[model samples]
Target: MTTHTPYGDDPSQYAELTLPDGAPRGVAVLVHGGFWKPEHDIEHAQPLVPSLVEAGWATWAIEYRRGTGAADTLADVRAAIAACPVEHPVRVAIGHSAGGHLAAWAATQQVGLTHVVSQAGVLDLRAAHDAGLGGGAVARFLGHPPGEADAGVDPIRQVPLAVPLWCVHGRADDVVPLAQSQAYVAAATAAGGAAELIEVAGDHFDVIDPASEAWARVLGLIEQLGRPAG
Candidate 1:
């Protein structure tokens, strides 16, 4: 672990970078999820980062302002990626829960992020809001109802994300629910984007635990990202 690097003047606009033992196979930008709330910081990413670094990938765990306006949150992501030290190519975004939403949304923009791994991301803002998940966290993040936000604000609206997006959703996840990943993959593939869903057994937090099989599954996905699909 290296010192925190600031992408912008704001305190929230920073990232923690970790290098691998040898040459990195790629770069991974980690986004933590706390249902887009201020209380949820980037520290929760610890469980997931080591696995990535041990896998021989340089990792950047970013922190952004939560519950802030949509644009502000997204600006943080774009800047963090831009500020990352380019130790290698094959830049990828790995976001969990609320972070999953950020990762998927990042791909819709010109953020230079080529691939995405959404772990139980709140991909569908409208659906999330409708289901009232996170106790109205979606509405709080939008600063308005989800219906009022632009189509681009929702990841589901931006299908065929112009990059490969793999969603790892826990079948037993009651937080974001497996439906989020299922619907996203359905929409993404239907729109011609390279999207996949890997169903695993566990709750929302299981996906982040390094000791869990879910993390093992994620490691496999990272390996696949470095290789050209045959």
Candidate 2:
């Protein structure tokens, strides 16, 4: 995998690796989940990059500042998307865990991101905070308690655009729980947006285990979303 930091000024900050293909369907940005904390780095997503490259889709795995400034992660995402070849036909944003929340936010801020996929993502920040998942490092990223941010930045409160939304969750997930994705699907549907919620056998980590069936399901969703531009 070739490494190039889109924002070279940031140093070896966020590295991107694009699959080598003559005519690719499009590109997918895989946002790794770490609850927007410093402990979980982008290296955690390295294993899944090859699988995406094999599928004829280019993938960009991003790294950003976590914690209270984590809200700025969207800026890094926009930079990554802008760094890609403008001719790519389709573009999809995919993320796991906390990254899912960021992906959803990115979709709202930018145009041309035709699809979004959240894998066992923490979609409802308010719910997460209430469930005690938003404390500590998470609280720092959110910059507020669950009760306060619930009305503003919560994915559940956002109005999704016409872009196709896919939410995948493990039936056995205990970290973020399946309810996170369930809540998001409900909100997207209520907003008159197209959203699909898929359930698979596994837990939070198992779903993204790469070798697990759930990972395959995620890849399938990406292929469907990253259709040839035309």
Candidate 3:
């Protein structure tokens, strides 16, 4: 795992997992989420790095500013992608939990992205806050009341960036809830965005458990996106 310091004043950091071969099929940037709390960083997704690399894709394990004190993780994600070698186009953004929300947001900022894979993503920030997920780190990340989070940063309310979005959630996830992904799909589709929803069997962390069958299913989504669009 090769680490790279972001090109800004922020203390944000990131790392990369390159394929053994010379050129990569594409780049997959993994964004971790602990409801945007400072306690959880990108390292949470480290276990899943080899999953993409083994599939011929280079991976960038991202550690963006988490709390309200630092820059928005959304901005950090954009900077990290911008810093990536232009030659290796960003094939997709795979974000888990809050990172999933960020990935969905990042997909809108770029034009050539293959797609966005949201793993247990937060489609409605306000909903999470309202449901009391925002009491701790989540509240700091969103910088507002639960109602504000629902009405303000809701991914559904934002303009669709026109990239294909695949939202996956564990049918039994209690922390982020499966309904979040469903709501996001509904909003994305209503906004004319390309969206796909998959209900896998697992809990919050199990969704990223590389050993679980659910992990393989998520990678399948990435592989399908890597192929040339018809």
Candidate 4:
């Protein structure tokens, strides 16, 4: 059974936990993307939780306040990650689209995360703001244009990730250009960080859909993340 636990007072500041039937291989924190809008909540990510649970993972599908602005959205993610039990064998985060951006950002905060996976994530805030992706969604989230936004939160600007990172993007994703992941991976690698970009044949949503082949690749990456470091 799944359990809903609130990390904060806000209705959006909650996470749905899906426990495995037996000993879990690890814990996965799932973040959904809806252009950082209120209309897109955690429900869209619910379908992926069962798959993770079946794979012997305890999943925490987080819901953070979006559309309000970047600060609130980020705060909620940070709080939810902090709420994770320290006794878990491993902890990884997977985020799609805007959530991908958050997942990457969270890894840089020295949050004790084991690994991070960005599935079609918006890693470059400046580029995203310049391209006007999601109809000025970045500007709305940051409350400023890319040039004036905080550098700390911009994943591309903050290179040399603290934890292992894997980015999976669909080659056919028209909504968020594949270049977003490419540039971030390149930047992270140049900074002497451990990062990789996995390209697949699918659209934006394919990476998040549990039944899609793109999701199968995501699962493989997650499995790699759970492996012990040699």
Between candidates 1 and 2, the lDDT winner: 1
Tens-place lDDT per residue, model 4, 112-152, is 67888999999999999889899999888888887744888
Q: Candidate 4: which stretches are off by over 4 Å?
A: 227-230
Please provide, for model 1 over 49-153, each residue's C-alpha lDDT reduced to its tens digit, 9 standing for 90 to 100. Answer: 887888878888999877778778988887787788764558899999999999988887776788999999999999999999999998888888788446787
Model 2, stretches more than 4 Å misplaced?
Answer: 134-137, 147-152
TM-score of 4: 0.95
Model 1 local distance difference test score: 0.87
Q: Estimate each model's TM-score.
A: 0.95, 0.90, 0.88, 0.95
Clashing pairs in 3: 126-149, 126-150
Residue pairs with colliding backbones in model 2 are 67-141, 68-140
Question: Arrange candidates by TM-score, highest first: which order?
Answer: 4, 1, 2, 3
Q: How do the residues 18-129 of candidate 3 rate in per-residue lDDT, one tens digit apiece? A: 5534556678878898888878887788888887777877777777777654246667777776666535544788889888888877776663456788999988766776
Candidate 2 local Cα displacement, residue 112, angstroms: 2.8
What lDDT is reached at residue 160 by model 1? 74
